[model samples]
Target: MIQPHQHADQACSECTQRLGLIESGLRGVTPVRFNAAGWYRGELRREILRLRLNQDVSVLKAITFALQRTLPAKALLVPIPSWKTQKRANPLPALICRSLGRTTKTLLKRCRPTVGQHHLSRRQRLVNMKSAFAIHPDQQSWCVSATPTWIVDDILTSGATAQEALHTLKRAGLEVRGLICLGRTP
Candidate 1:
C-alpha cells in the first residue's frame, strides 16, 4: 500500500489543505521528499519538467512503480492535460497512467491556454487555471458511468490544475475519487 513519506512536514500538509483543493472530501496522494524550493533545485525536478521535452523510459518506469503502489486498484485514471491545445502536447501524465497498468481515460481537454504555475503564487495559479479545462467533446457520454476516477499528474504543487480538473469532470457528471501525483510541493 502507499505510505506517506516520513519527511513530510506539517507545513506541507497545511499548504495543500489551506489551498482548499481537497475540500471535496477526496484523498490527495503525493510523496513529499522535499519542499517546493528544494525540489526545484533537485534533479527530480529537471527529470519531471523535461518529460514533455523528452520521454525518458527509465524515469517513467520508476515514477509509475512508485505511484502504482499507492493508487486504488479500482480507480480509473484520467490525466490532466497540459496547457497546450495540441493533442499529446505533454504525455507525462498519460504515460504515467498507462504505466500503472490501470484503466486510463483521456476525458479532459484544455479549453484555453494558461501561464505555467511554476512561478506563480497560489492565488495567481488558481486564477490562471480558472475554466482552463473542459470535458472532451467525445468523452461527454463517458461521464454517464459513475466510475471511481482519479486525476493523474506529474506533481501536485498549489493544486490549481487538479482542482480545475476535478471541477470540470464533476460538472460533466463523473465520480472523481481524488488526485494522485508523483510528487507534492511543500
Candidate 2:
C-alpha cells in the first residue's frame, strides 16, 4: 500500500548528475523514492515494477500522473528497450510512457543482449550498456519530429541505460530532451 508523496515535484539533482545530463536538462523527474537496500520499501518497489497485480498498476499510474505535469507539451516519450530482444521481454517503460498520455514510441531496440544492471557497479553498468541500443529500423522515418523527446522508464539507477538510449536517439537525429522515470534510487 504505497501512497503518493505530498511534497512538490522536483527533479533529483543527484540523479541528473549521475545521468550526466547537461545543466538545466529536462530530465530526472522521479516522484517515487526508492531504497534498493531496504527491506520494506525495496520489496514494494520491486512489486510495483513487476506489474503483476492491479495494485501495482494503480501505484504506477498515480506516479505517472504526477510525472505527466512536469513534461513539456507534446513531448515524445521513448521507452528504453529491455536487454532481452523479445518484443515484450520488459514492458514497464512502455507502460509508463503510455501512462504519461504522451506520444509514446518504441523507437529504440536492444542491439545486443546484456546482463542485468542491478548487481553491477556504475562502471560495469556503463560497459554493459555500451552500444546496447539502436534505432528501430521500422521507426526510422519517425525520427524527423521537432517534438522534444524524453526517455521513459520505471526507475533510474546508474543511468547507463538512459545514457545509451539518449545516444542512440541523438545519433538518429532526434531531439532527446532527457529522461523521465517513476522512481530514483536514493
Candidate 3:
C-alpha cells in the first residue's frame, strides 16, 4: 500500500525470518506491488522493468517521491550493487539513489560480477552472491561508523542478495539497519 511514512526502529525480527537477515530491518511504507494483479500490476511491472533495463525514469517518479518521504532521516542509504557488469547504465538501485541522496547516500560497489539468481535455489543464490560486493575505498570512512544504513534494492525474493550484501557490509565494519525495496516477489 506504500504508506507515506514509516518509522525506523533500532531493529526488527520480521526481516530476519523472511530474509535470514541480521543487522537490518525492512524499509517503511512501501508495499510489494509485483503480483498478478493490484496497484503495481501489469503496466507498473513493465515500467519497472523498463526502468531497470533502460534507465527510464519516466515512470519511477512516484516511487522516488514516496522514498524521499519515507526514508529514515538519520541513516545513509547503501544501494545493493547492480547486476549489470558492463556499467550500471540503468538499474533500480542506481535510479533510486539519484533521488534518495538527501536522506541517504551510497557506500558500496560491486567488486565482481555475479551469476544471475533467476533460476537458482536458495542455497545457490546465497553461494552465488557470496562476497559479491565491496565497500568503495573512498567510502571506507562510511564503513567505520556504527551508524545504521538502509540497504536498498529493487525487489525481495529469497533475500539471498540482501543477506549477502549485509554480510559484505558487516565484513567491512558497516552496520546495516534495514532492507528497502520497490517490490517483493509474489
Candidate 4:
C-alpha cells in the first residue's frame, strides 16, 4: 500500500482536495502552478517533498482507476523533460508517470535544452519549448508496440509543453492517448 510518510509529513490542502476530486470521477483535473501562484513555495515543496512524494498521488490514482476500468491494455507514461537535470534532482512529471506506469518505467526524454517556460511569454514559451522533447532512441523497442500514451506533467498552463511532447512522440510513431496533469489554470 502507498504510505503518506513515504513522501512527506506535510500535505497541502490543494493536494488533498485534488486527491479527492481525482478519486471521485477523474474530471476537473487542474494543474498545480509552481511559479506564478507560488504553489511551488519552499514550504509547500518541503511539505510535499519538493514533489518527490508523488505529491499528485491523487491524480495518479484517478488515472490508474480509470485505466483499470476503461483501457486494461498496457500504457506508457511519458513526461516532459526538465532542461536542467542537476538542480531539481528528479523530474516531477517523469516521477509521477513512473508511479502510474504498469508495464514500463518511462519513455519520454528531453533531447534538447530549452529555457524555462515560466519567464517566457505565451509566444516565447511555445517557441522556447519547441523540439525540446524526444523519445529516447534506446526505448524505441518498448514504444514501438505501445500505443496511446499519457503525457504527464505537474501542471497544464498553455499546454505548449505537453503538446510539444506529444508532437515529438507522434513523430516517432507513438500514439498519444491523452494528457494528464496535477492541475490546470481554468
Against the hidden true structure, what lDDT does model 3 obtain?
A: 0.58
Q: Could you give me the TM-score of model 3 versus the true structure?
A: 0.68
After superposition, candidate 3 runs with Cα above 4 Å error:
1-41, 88-90
What would the TM-scores of all predictions be?
A: 0.72, 0.73, 0.68, 0.65
Ranking of all predicted structures according to lDDT, beginning with the best and ending with the worst: 2, 1, 3, 4
lDDT for residue 84 in candidate 3, whole number 0-100? 79
Across residues 1-186, which tens digit of lDDT does each residue of candidate 1 receive?
112224631123433333322322223343212112123224555556776677765545544444565567877889888876666567778887776778988899888889867789989988998999988888878898777888888777877888889889888888887776655654
Model 4 TM-score is 0.65
Error of 4 at 72 (Å): 4.2
Worst ten-residue run, lDDT, model 4?
29-38
Cα lDDT for residue 76, model 1? 86
Q: Which ten residues in a row have the lowest lDDT in candidate 3?
A: 30-39
Given candidate 3, what's the lDDT at residue 34?
Answer: 16
Over 1-186, each residue of candidate 3 has an lDDT whose tens digit, in order, gives 122223531112342223222232223332221111112334444555766666644334444544555555676677776767647433677666555554455677777778778899988987888878777788777778877677877767777888777777788887676576655554
Query: lDDT by residue for model 2 over 1-186, one digit each (tens)?
Result: 444435423224443233332333234333212111111235435654556334355445544554676678788989887776565466777777766678888899888989988799999999998999989999999899888888877667777887888888988899987777655665
lDDT of each: 0.65, 0.66, 0.58, 0.54
Residue 163 alpha-carbon offset, candidate 4, angstroms: 0.6
